[model samples]
Target: MKKIVTLLCLGILLVNCSNNDDEMDIENSTEIVVDETQEMGTDMYVGNFVSLAHPTSGVVSVSDDMSRLDFKNFKTDNGPKLLVYLTTDTDATEYVNLGDLKGIEGDYNYTIPDGTDIGKYKLVNIWCVDFSVSFGYAELKK
Candidate 1:
């Protein structure tokens, strides 16, 4: 009887499993919406890149929840490996590495680390790991 009950419970959980709709909704919101932003009280940290080693154009927006960092209209010359960062230093010497960038074109979001102190990180950098080069960077401000 114990074995049968255990199997039945596991089967029920598997049947109920579905795509996590809440997380999907946050990821899908790339463009900042006025009503949503007002309700959440999080104005997206918007910025644009200046030429460093590569020429790029785009807008990077971070949701006030810090759950999503979306890059829109983003373009950059291909490189070995690219990563995103929130940094206090322009050289990216002192920083928090967000995650591996999803792509160079189109819009995408990178998850911010839990308990990140957004106030300290004033710059966003797209860094090349293999070559230790900063392709471009943007400042985050109101």
Candidate 2:
């Protein structure tokens, strides 16, 4: 009887230990994926700049009064690099690259320089070199 009782206790202890190990393994295996889905139907503005789902009517004027291009549901391991461009009309396929705007984090702004030409412009694309992802055609009213 003593031997049987000892064996039963040992079995219970082993089962408990195995359960604990399994729980630890499950916890470690789980990972969270950020920026998996793009969130549409959101608009943001900084100073005179405005971003909508579709382009606005008339020429979207932009100037030094604008600060940063706002983004929704943007996630990254490090940060994103923005490429700003200017275009005259919608049918115009060619875009003039303004420059590369860096240091973009979540809900952050990129400063618009004083000499930036005031006209219809767009965010064009935001590149995340660290994550290897890019958001394209993010139109911005200058």
Candidate 3:
């Protein structure tokens, strides 16, 4: 009887531990949003990434001088990837492998393809293996 009771207690402890681990994973994730219009100047708009909860949502407005890609609080993992979806009349889509962007804890800048159509786009989702486990949304304005 004592042995059986011990086994049952161990099982419960294991389950509780597993739950805690999952909570930690979520707590570590983050998301960031930046609004260029609110701030003056061009360079001021860059590197505005901030730490936030995992699985967050936000928007990014682009200006005439804004032709770069930037991100905030992006988690790093063994294999990170970024998927960009453009909402236009024809629905264009692109994918960028984020392997090089991993471990970048703060804001960073990236180059957008030249001649990207001027319109609003939604950042459908973002995912990483170790650093972040969340997704965000944004709109590009011209």
Q: What lDDT would each prediction earn against the true structure?
A: 0.75, 0.40, 0.41
Q: What shift in Å separates residue 75 of candidate 2 from its native position after superposition?
A: 4.2
| CA error at residue 77 for candidate 1, angstroms | 0.8
lDDT by residue for model 2 (1-142), tens:
4566567777866765777453545433433333422322123322222333222121122223454344433332234454544434333244455456443333433455555443454544434334443433444541
TM-score of 3: 0.36
Per-residue lDDT of candidate 3, residues 21-89 (tens digit): 545554544333345444433432222222222433333333346566655444422344534333332
- Give one digit per residue, the lDDT tens place, for model 1 in 18-130: 55543444443333223545532465677887668888678777786777677777888878888889988668888899988778787777788888766788788888889
Q: How accurate is candidate 2 locally (lDDT)?
A: 0.40
Candidate 1's C-alpha runs over 4 A off are: 1-42
1 or 3, which is superior by TM-score?
1
Candidate 2 backbone collisions, by pair: 62-142
Candidate 1 minimal-lDDT segment of 10 residues = 27-36
TM-score of each: 0.67, 0.30, 0.36
Pull out the clashing pairs in model 1. Answer: none
Error of 3 at 34 (Å): 18
